[model samples]
Target: MSSTPKRVLVVEDETEIRELIALHLRREGYLVDDLGTGDLARTQLSKQPYDMVIVDWMLPGLSGLELTRWIRTELKQLQLPILFVTAKTDPEHVAAGLDAGADDYLAKPFDTLVLMARVNALMRRKSWMDSFNVESEQSPHAHILIGELKLDRDAYEVYLRDEKLDLTKSEFKLLEALMMSQGKVLTRKTLIELIQGDGVNVVGRTVDTHVFGLRKKLKDHSELIETIRGVGYRVKLLNG
Candidate 1:
C-alpha cells in the first residue's frame, strides 16, 4: 500500500492568520487544509485523519480547549499533535492549553521563525507517532527495566517497582534518557540537550533540578538512580 502524504489541518477563525499558516506550511512541503470554524474543524477531523491540528484558542462555536479534550477523551488511539496558536500567553492559558492535550503551542503575535520552529516540532512528533506500533487494539508499550525503576513509553508513565511515580514532563524525559542508557552514565549536559530540544534556553543546573525532583518522586526506589559524583547519573540495569 502507498503511504499517504502527511496532512495538517489549520483551524482558526481569523482569515489572515489561517491563510498565513497554511501558506507557510505548504511552502514547507506539507499538505495543508484550512478551516474557519471549530465546527468545520470537528467535521473534517471526523471524516479524515490529520497528522497534526493547529488550532486557535477562541472560536465562535467550540473552543480549542474543548476540542482538545474531545480529541483526547474520544480518540485515545489517535495521538495526533495539537498545536495552539493564539494571543493568550498568560501562564494559566498556556497551562490550560497543555492540560487540554495540546502537544505544543505558539503565542501570538509570533514571529514566522518561531511559528515554523513549533510547526516543525509538531511534525517531528507526528513522525514519531507514525513510527510507533499502532496495529493492535492496545498500543505497544515500551518498558526500560533498570532494576527497580521502570519507564513506560506507551502510557508516558513511569513506576518504581510496583509503586507509581508521578513525574513532570522534564523529569520524565530525564528519567527516560537515564533508563535507556541502562547503566551507562549520562552527563547533565547531555540530558538537558536531549530533553529541551534545540532552541530552548536550558542551563546545566536545570538538569540538576529535574533530577532532584525525579529522585524525590521515585521515593524508596531513589537508589535505582545513581549519581556518578563528578560525572552525571545512571539507572542500574535489572539483570546486570
Candidate 2:
C-alpha cells in the first residue's frame, strides 16, 4: 500500500487552476488527470477509477457540487474522496459544498503549500483506509454481524438464523444504513441521503419502498427494523 502511487482527477474549468493542482500533485508522486468540464470528468471517471477527486465549485456544465454528489451516489462502494476547490468561501457556499458530498474544501487564491498539505492529508487517510480494508475478508458474519443475523457485505447476502435471505442492492443499502446508525432514528431525509446520497432525486417515500422490501427479506427478524411513524427507521438493538 505504501508504494502504490495514487491517481487523482482534477475537474476545474479554469485552465490555470487545473494545471496548478496537477503540478503540485505530480510533485507529490500522484498521477493526475486534469479535465476542464464536468462531462469530460464524468466520462473519465467511468472509464478509469481515481483514488481521489478535486472538483471546482463552478464548472460551466453540471457544476462541481452536483458532480461530487453524482459520484457519491453512483459509486457508493468505491466511495472516492472529493475535495472542492473554489473561490466561494462564504459560509453558505461552504455548507452547501459539504452537504453536497465534499470530503474537504479549498478556497480560491489558496496557497500552493496549503493545497499540498490538504492533498497529503487526504492521501494519507486513503492509505490508512486501504490498510484497514485488507482485513475485510475475515468472515461474512464477522464483518457485519448483528445478533443472529449477518449482513454479508462481500457476498452481498444477508443471513438470519443460518438461512440466507434474498436482498436487492437497495435493500442492502437500506439495511447497511440502519446498521451503521446503531439504534439512532434515521430521519427519512437522512436515510435517503445516506443510502442514495445527494445525486438521486428520490422523494421521501422512495425510502419506504426499499425498507418495505427489506423488512420482508428479514422475515421474523423484521422486528429489528422499527419504523418511527413520522420520524424514520431504526434498527432496534436486541434486548433494548
Candidate 3:
C-alpha cells in the first residue's frame, strides 16, 4: 500500500502562478491546496495542518510576510516549513523573509526544477524531524537537563529557569544537537548533516543563522551555548 501523500499549501495571488505551482507539486505526488489570499489561506491553515507552505510575498489581504509572522507568533506553528515565492529579489528583502519565518526563498520567475528541488529538500528535512521526535519518545535520553536549561524531546519544548522558550524548528534542532552531544564541539558540517539530513544542499552559514537566533532566544543564559570560533558550537558543561 502506498503511504499518504505529503500535503502542501500554496498561497499566491496570481491565478496562473498558483495553478502552475500546484500542478507541478501535484505531479511530484504532493497533495496541494492553492489559495489566492493570505486571509483565506490562514483560515484554511487553521482548520488543517500542512507539511509545507509556498507563499508569494504579495497577497490581496494579509501579505505573505504578515501571514508568515502570524503563523510563527499567533498560530505558533514553528515546525511548519514556509517557502517564499516573490518578485522581491533584493538581498534585504530575502533577509526580511527569512527573519519573518520563511524556511526558504525563491524569487519570481523561478525555475520549476529549482522550486521542486527546494520543496523536496524541505519535505525530507521535515520527515527526518518527525522520525526523530518519534524515536526520541521511545529512548532513555528523551529529556535533558543541564543547569537551568531543560529540554523535553517528547514535547519538543525548551525551558530555561522554568520559563518556556518559543523557538523555530531549525533553532530547536540546533539546540537538540548541541545538548545531545553536550560539552563536545560539533563541526558546522556535522551539525548541518545532523539537522538537515544527508543530501540537502544546506550551507554552513545557515547553521550560524539558526545558532544566532537560538542564542538570542536563550536570553540571559545565552552563553550556555558556546561558540568555538572556527570550529562549531557546544553546550557548556555544568557540574552537578
Best by lDDT: 3
TM-score of each: 0.76, 0.59, 0.70
When superposed on Cα atoms, how far off is each prediction in RMSD?
A: 4.6, 10.3, 5.7
Better of 1 and 2 by TM-score: 1
lDDT for model 2, on a 0 to 1 scale? 0.75
Cα error, candidate 2, residue 127 (Å): 1.4
In model 3, how large is the Cα lDDT of residue 201? 55
Task: Please list all clashing residue pairs in model 3, or write none if there are none.
Answer: none
Q: Worst lDDT window (10 residues) for model 3? A: 193-202
Model 2, span 133-240: residue lDDT tens: 564544323457778888765445688988988775557757865775557788887665544422234568999988888888788877889999999999987772
Query: Which regions of candidate 2 are displaced past 4 Å?
Result: 138-240
Clashes of each: 1, 0, 0
Which tens-of-lDDT digit does each residue in 123-221 have in candidate 3?
Answer: 876765566556554353367787788888656689998789998756777888788667889889767754552213567898888889998999988
- lDDT for position 209 in model 2: 84
lDDT of each prediction vs. the true structure?
A: 0.74, 0.75, 0.82
lDDT of 3 at 69: 92
